[model samples]
Target: MKAPTNRRRAIAKALTALLPLAPYADMEKIRAEAGRAHLHNLPPTIAVWLAIIAHIRHAHTDYEKLLADGYDRDSARFFVIEQTNIVLTRWRATRFLDADDESE
Candidate 1:
């Protein structure tokens, strides 16, 4: 197969694996809507990762603001750093493991 095809396939597989079941609090209508949402506007895994990275980067300033408002800096800092690591690991795994597939 061509490089771009392989990359798309790899990224699709990763996205499928990461896709979570929509939460339903016993509401059939809501559940159905969620399913439709998943089908209609699903974004690429790379887009999701980029969003997460952007959120993490934005949180730094938000965290500082909260700290100035007298919130605990350590807790906020730890939470931000911890989530950052999680996203980074996924990004690395997707980039490295799928390198040959051109999915990175």
Candidate 2:
């Protein structure tokens, strides 16, 4: 297969420019997930950011472990909000998640 088809390249480019601190493994997973999300025809920017957030949620925090250990999705997410925000800051994200704002 030809490497980095245009779609993959577009996602990768956006991620590299946006989340430059992301490790290689994280970037690869984000690129692949973003590529799949593009099938929904979301804009590249939307897809990239969505994938980035999902990666941080699943990889950087205990969100997934909580789910595996029997916490419901919402509760698991609640437990990890600050953790995700920390990773978000470490990655120099333009936006940070605010749990209180979402609590309403």
lDDT tens digits, residues 1-104, model 2? 22247767777778887787867788888888888833348766678877887888998899888999999988888888899888877877676667775531
Clashes of 1: 0
Model 2: lDDT of residue 51: 80
Superposed model 2: Cα runs more than 4 Å off: 1-4, 37-39, 100-104
lDDT of each: 0.40, 0.76
State the weakest 10-residue window (summed lDDT) of model 1: 95-104
TM-score of 1: 0.24
The residue-level lDDT of candidate 1 at 1 comes to 21
